[model samples]
Target: MFIEERTADDLALIRLLDAAFAELVARYGLEGRSGVGPGAHYLVAVVDDETVGCVAVQTTDVAGTGEVKRMYVAPAARGQGIARALLKEIESRATDLGYDRLRLVTGHLQPAAIALYESAGYRRTEPYGTYADRPGTFCYAKSLAG
Candidate 1:
């Protein structure tokens, strides 16, 4: 599979994001929300020219930090490392964009996602931003500095 940077509005990436939102809503019984915004960076994973996974990063209020958003891999594409690759690519792009750290929030219902982030070296962090008071939200952060 090949992964490359893409725009937040890319059609295929939008479809993936929609699917991810739907899954989150079903899993968490909450309304879907969009995380893409101005200046966000996106990366898509493609296999046989078909986009199967995507991730994005956007600047956070915290200086030198970025927030990871819209990380998803199609259900059929799981187990192939697509999500992991997309995440790694986005982290690299965020670091290149001058972010010294990255943070993300995922619901506790998503054990697989939590495992992925933890296995990737992210550690639990105090909730921040809109998630600060939201229960069941699992916040994590990882420093990009070497």
Candidate 2:
């Protein structure tokens, strides 16, 4: 498997993101809406040429911080550590971009996701941004060394 950066107009990735986010809403009753426009940078995980997972890294006002947005791994690829790989890749990019902190907001109902972040050294934090307006939004943050 490999990861590649995707352009904003990549329709295939946009469809994948739509499906992934729809699942999030169906599973946790999430609103799944974002005011952040469509230019967010995306990374696609390909396994044998098939898009198995994807993640987006976006900028924020918080100095040295990178936001994890729209992370999703296809169901068949879930147990294979693809999500973790994608996250690690994103983190690496964040660090290279001079971000010292990485943060993400996920629904509490997604236990597996929470576990993934926790095992990756992320810690639970108070609600941030739009998540603060909704209940059960579990936010996690990890401060980088460099």
Candidate 3:
């Protein structure tokens, strides 16, 4: 798998995101929500010319901070380290962009993702950013400073 930064509005990435959003909507009821918005950079995972997974990041209200968003891997692409790779790429890119810290919030609907974050050295943190008031949300954070 290859990961590269793309505009948040890339067409192929949009298609993959639509697929993921549809699944998330059915599972999490996140309807009428648009993704990433402007100013967020996206990382797309391409495998054999197919866009299988993606993640996005943007500046948070917190100074020197960035927030992870729109992270998803196609169901058929699971178990192949795509999510982990995406996480690593996001972290690396965030660090390179001068962000000293990164944070993300994933819902309880994804236990595996929670475990993945924990395993990646992201510790459970209190509610943060816009997710602070959302119930069933689990927040995690990692210091990206080297």
Compared with the true structure, what per-residue lDDT tens digits does model 1 show for residues 1-146? Answer: 99988887689988998999899888876644645779888889999989999888998889999999999999999998888888888889998999999999988888999999999999999988778888888899999999
Candidate 3 Cα misplacement greater than 4 A, ranges: 31-34
The number of clashing residue pairs in each candidate reads 0, 0, 0
- Which wins on lDDT, candidate 1 or candidate 3? 1
Task: Please write out the lDDT profile of model 3 over residues 1-146, one tens digit for every residue.
Answer: 79998886689888888887787788679642445757888999999988899998888878888988888898998999999999999999998788999888787888988988899999889997566787888888889877
Clash list (residue pairs), candidate 3: none
Against the true structure, candidate 2 has what lDDT?
0.84
Residue pairs with clashing backbones, model 2: none
- Kindly report which residue stretches of model 2 are placed more than 4 angstroms away from their true locations once superposed: 35-39
| Per-model TM against the reference | 0.95, 0.92, 0.92
Which candidate has the top score in TM-score? 1
Q: How many clashing pairs does model 2 include? A: 0
Model 1 RMSD in Å is 1.1
Q: Which TM-score value belongs to model 2?
A: 0.92
Please give the range of 10 consecutive residues that has the lowest summed lDDT in model 1: 28-37
**Superposition TM-score, candidate 3 onto the true structure:** 0.92
